[model samples]
Target: MGINTTKLKRGFRELFGKTVQAFIVQLRMETGLMLIENTDLSISEIVYRVEYSYPASFTQAIRNHYGKTPQALRCLA
Candidate 1:
């Protein structure tokens, strides 16, 4: 196939207004929010399930993208 990682990532960002990684993270956040709102999964569990390599990084990404930590978001929900 002609699609390389760089081109694919660029196309994803062009089409979605976020890099592929960011978009995936966004999706994970959305779902995580839903889970937080509706389910009983612990924060750490959600972090791991979201595919972040570590809880700290996931918390950082959540803060960076949503302007809130996962715990804060859960509190808000």
Candidate 2:
């Protein structure tokens, strides 16, 4: 926590092979996917749970990451 912004970014990128933003998006998308697959929660609820402000954005993220819509993914599950 004491590190400067540049140093923190560098260290994080070196350790994680991606920027902090990418890592966070990856975590959110993964969590969203899990919820979609295993829970009965609605798409809007899942978007809120994943910290997205809009269902459309969350759906776009899911599509970008998995090449499937949330509903499509849920159907597979």
1-77 per-residue lDDT for model 1 (tens digits): 78898898888888999987777878988887777677779878888787777889878877887899888888887
Clashing pairs in 1: none
After superposition, the stretches of candidate 2 with alpha carbons farther than 4 Å from their true spots are: none
**Residue lDDT tens for model 2, 5-65:** 9999999999999999999999999999999999999999999999999999999999999
The Cα local distance difference test for each model comes to 0.82, 0.97
Each prediction's RMSD over C-alphas, in Å, is 2.0, 0.7
* Shift of residue 41 alpha carbon in model 2, Å: 0.3
Count clashing residue pairs per candidate.
0, 0
Candidate 2 CA-lDDT value: 0.97
lDDT of 2 at 20: 100
The positional error of residue 61 in candidate 1, measured at the CA in angstroms, is 1.5
Return the TM-score for candidate 2, rounded to 2 decimals.
Answer: 0.96
